[model samples]
Target: MPRDADATKERILAAATAEFATHGYAGGRVERIASQAKSNVRMIYAYYGGKSSLFDATVAEALRRMAENVPPRPDDLAEWAGDVFDHHQRFPDVLRLSMWAQLERPEATAEPSEAYRDKTLAVATADASPLSPVDVLVFVYAIAQAWQLSPAGLTGLEEATDESETVAARRRSVVIAVERMLQKGP
Candidate 1:
């Protein structure tokens, strides 16, 4: 693809990511994505095939970025959990997109990406804990995202005072929880 086409595609992906994260696949509108991207509906169809295809691409790209930004650390699962928590805080849209995919694309959930596969293998090889590798990975991920996915009313307690301090405290809690889980095993 030419440079202009590449840039346009990126813009479309960004717009689509935000749209789908907010509205989910069924409710996401290609027209709005097009408008947000400063491109037209025809281009989105031409570039991504259709709305469904675009949504798939958007979700894939978001996951790819997350894997790149927050690759697993098998040796230090607690720090890894902290990194994941930080990633979610910095890019809340990624978590939203993930949740949207889980709700709307159940079939797609079965296939693990290479990044996830590598992480699982690393975790298994590095840790001799009783917990299965998959379970460890899932547990760490759940703990990392717990704050972000919590009810707004619950989170409001953290945000009631100094935002940075509360967020840092939450992050510390995530790290400590993961550390304890690793130490205790399952």
Candidate 2:
């Protein structure tokens, strides 16, 4: 594509990501994405086909970026979990987009991408845990995202004034939990 077209597509994806992350597929608005992207509806349609397609593209792009930015460190699963926690903290929109996708497109979420496959394989090869590789991977991810995904009421740190300290504590907990899980072979 031409430079202008590429820039326009990137803008559309960025706007669509923000829209879908906040509103989900059912509530996301194509017109709003178009307006935020500084592009017209016709161009969005021409580039992405329609609302659903654009949403899918946006989610795919988000996942791709996450995978690229945070590739698993199978040898050091604890630190890997911490990295995952940091990634979610830094890019809360990605987590929101993922939650929206899971809620709105359950069937699509089960399809394993190459990134997942690679992570699973790496875990299986690097660890000697009795638990299955998939289980190990899932547990690490769950622990890493637990604090972020939890309801505000469940997070007892609501009264905390120093957000950085709260985040650091949570991240340390995530790393410790993953390390214990690996050590216990569960």
Candidate 1 C-alpha lDDT tens digits along 39-98? 999999999999888888888888888889998898898899999999999999989988
lDDT score for residue 153 of model 1: 89
In candidate 2, stretches whose alpha carbon ends up further than 4 angstroms from where it belongs are: 1-3, 107-112, 157-161
Report the lDDT of model 1 for residue 129.
50
- Model 1 shows how many backbone clashes? 0
Clashes of each: 0, 0
Kindly list the per-residue Cα lDDT of model 2 for residues 28-89, writing each as its tens digit.
99999999999999999999999988888888888889889999898898999999999999
Per-prediction TM-score, please? 0.93, 0.93
Off by over 4 Å in 1: 1-3, 108-112
Error of 2 at 105 (Å): 1.5
Query: Root-mean-square deviation of each candidate, in angstroms?
Result: 2.2, 2.1
